[model samples]
Target: MATDPNGTTQSDDAIDPVEEENVSGRASFTASLLTQGRHRFYTLSMPSDVLANTCVVEPRNEDPEEGFQRALDEKRARDIANYIDAGMGTIPTSIVLSAQPAANLQYKRTNRTLSFELNQRAFLILDGQHRVFGFRLAKTSLRVPVVIYNGLNRMEEARLFMDINTKQRPVPNELILDIKRLADTESDAEALMRDVFDLFDKNADSPLLGLMSASERRKGRISRVTFNGAMKAISDSFSGASAEQIYDVLSAYLICCKSGLREYSMEDLIVNPTMFKALMLIFPTIAERVNDRHPSSFTVAHFDEIVSPMFQRSKRAELSNPGKSPSLLVDSFRKALRSGFTIGGGNAV
Candidate 1:
């Protein structure tokens, strides 16, 4: 084995007969020399010390499947592939972190490649950096689509990177949910549900909730805008209301079934104040029969067991007191719910 002055072996491991023939047939490439056919050129840097970091061999990369997908997403892999294909054997190497602020993306050279890998290193994400980084990694294995620029200016590189990622909006939430497992494999679904309930409690009391929840669901469809607006209104008690008032509103809704959770469907609630009172009565009655059930989206069995009896009692009481006010039935139902059945063991149902 013969050693080059650069400490690289010129042994059979490094050079094959075909490569030797090619080297003999062609003159060594010089960075300072360029043909005049094309006016465009890209600039890259190398260390003034030659043997310190001798670049050798063709462009190559070794990465896994997951890495490839992430690179595609960030456009890093694409940029790298493009740079190599444009005949840049060793593109400029910057000993700097990534472009984003507060990022520490240091890079260096290994073999003929300009890389970011270290013996023992960790990467801290700064901003939209994931794309270019991913692109760089992904391109390590594949070829890229590159549009060579004049002098390979730093601003020009920045512009190209920005154009690849910034122009597109993110994918939709439902689609993201479909890929939720990829984002967080160890997620807690039950905890997520509890958080949702807590959020509901936080926003259940508002005229907007009374207004928008009462708004018709259009043709079996509810839009994101509609849902978000309605939810936002009650989030933090109309924004300026006090915590006590917020609690009062929440408690009233919770106690009276003014919010959802009872067997009350859309048809049951067409208006506020009146329909609301009816709910206050009916929910407590129906909520009684279940063993492990909380106030939730009820099925047909719930309606049969709990709701029908309360409705009959309220109706009869209302009719018997005909000379009384128009809201007498609702009043009676509320009273019934207030003085409702037991909670545990044989006392329940």
Candidate 2:
């Protein structure tokens, strides 16, 4: 017999069928036995409440090889907990764990049932500690998929933990954004920005046609990651506007920029990620100026009439200063635009 954390005792030789409650008062459920090479494991669904109470994480001490897991990130756990409590989150991946010999876990192959005593520190969390902690914090209980490896020693557990954490490459943000766009799973703001990117890449009249690189960086092309980042700085400016409408205003602005700043190469000033973002940051003021003068007209010609003189007066060396930071460059451009313009015998630049 083995004693659990709560002083409950259970026979070590006991094995129960599916859906039966064992002597320790914990319910035993059906599980699938799986093997990879010589190693065997069991996959089962455990309720969040039970899982949270049963599993423990042993973070490494001052000794380098003492433990396998890292310290729990409290903020991440809180965020995940909040997401789960809001009824909008789902954890589809299995929480991987190892049952040490002390756990006394029993699996009945005839009925495909697995049961274990709730002994203190019975299971070691190999992965998904943050998620498990989130489950512990959430008010609602969830049926979580769990993979349990039985009778693994400390060294074996450590090796498995290292392999999982180090060998797997995380998905890139660019690919995630692209997937969200294609699957229509993104938020409204994200969807709108993605559509704007599509127009800039494919539209015939766009000044930036064939200049948006979706995956990786390319010569003379702006990456999707950079483009999305720049758009975020001005996304609020297009409130209540459709993707096409937003594209129209921006495309017109860029056309004017391309024409007015013809002295500099496209990659050097206009389409450079830093310069492009700086340009986007100042667009709201320019749009307001256009709206004030033309009253709802935002054409390329109208923008040119306003910005052409500013570009003419500005020095390329100063505008493309490599020493200045991106924010400083934006401020310099704003100052230049203000200093260059004079409306009705007063300083409007």
Candidate 3:
């Protein structure tokens, strides 16, 4: 460790980006830049228990696009709720409004009375907005687990959001697409999500992992091995996929067959055997569609299109013939993959 001329130990602040290369063997300037933010202590944490759901997180009206998007999500929320209920799950709760607060509103904890600007705007949730909204509609207790941030600037929040996500291990394209659709309307969404992600991190040890066939086992192993190195691995895998897309496509090819439009859920899609089996079915189709196409040309819409045929064919096998195999539907999916598709992108705005 180097010492200052005055004898204090040199810290990250003392590193001279102008003169050194980093331990990663990149120019020291790049590493030094990352450490610069270390001196800025902006984060504050409070007990997850004390956090109240007082701030009605309404959609911000400043952005017209936000309102339209919120309206669209509202449309989807009902469908999500139906699916969650059928599957015996719950979605996340929601606030009455959505916005960042300049600071958290002060309130009497037990009495639950607002002490500050009782009528003023409160902070909208950045993440898990749909869950909060859904749970509120269901008339459950409003208090839940959350990480409330003070002075949450939009750009900085976005940056912080992505930063926190990078802490997790990588995921498959289909796997990421599947979980991304989890609506706030699952029966016990927070718990379901925890169970789902817990299973995902633990690998194939969970019941859902057993859906893998011998061939799919080999393929999944290869895919995970190939993607173990980078963040882009998860992005690239999930880049051209979506929760709806993966769910619709995979629901057709299932063998053990648990997840369905009737039983659709964050928990079911992420950890149910039917969902895992569908992933096995989608991957190779994705590879064929790409055919080594332009790198930028890759997208989640392709994955959605890959299974459109299955979705179209099996809208309600529930009433007509629920027991037979969906091989015909799977064949239709393969054909759809061969024909190619055109769909758009994800916009969580």
The C-alpha local distance difference test score for the whole of candidate 1 amounts to 0.34
Question: lDDT for every model?
Answer: 0.34, 0.79, 0.36
Q: For residues 1-349, what per-residue lDDT tens digits would candidate 1 score against the true structure? A: 6677889777432332221111322211111212344433212232212111121111113334211112224355356446544654443332211222211222222222122222122222112233334333432332111111223233444444455447757766434433454546324532232233234434654322333321233332322233333233345322554445433433444433322323343332323333433443443344444324645434445444444444433444243333423256556665554443555533222
TM-score of each: 0.24, 0.74, 0.29
Winner by TM-score between candidate 3 and candidate 2: 2
Model 1 clashes, total count: 11
The residue-by-residue lDDT of candidate 3 on 211-329, one tens digit each, is: 33211224323222222221222233444554444333333323223322334322233332333333354455554543344343434344333333434344353213323333444
The most accurate candidate by lDDT is 2
Please list the Cα RMSD from the true structure of every candidate, rounded to 1 decimal place.
19.0, 7.5, 21.9
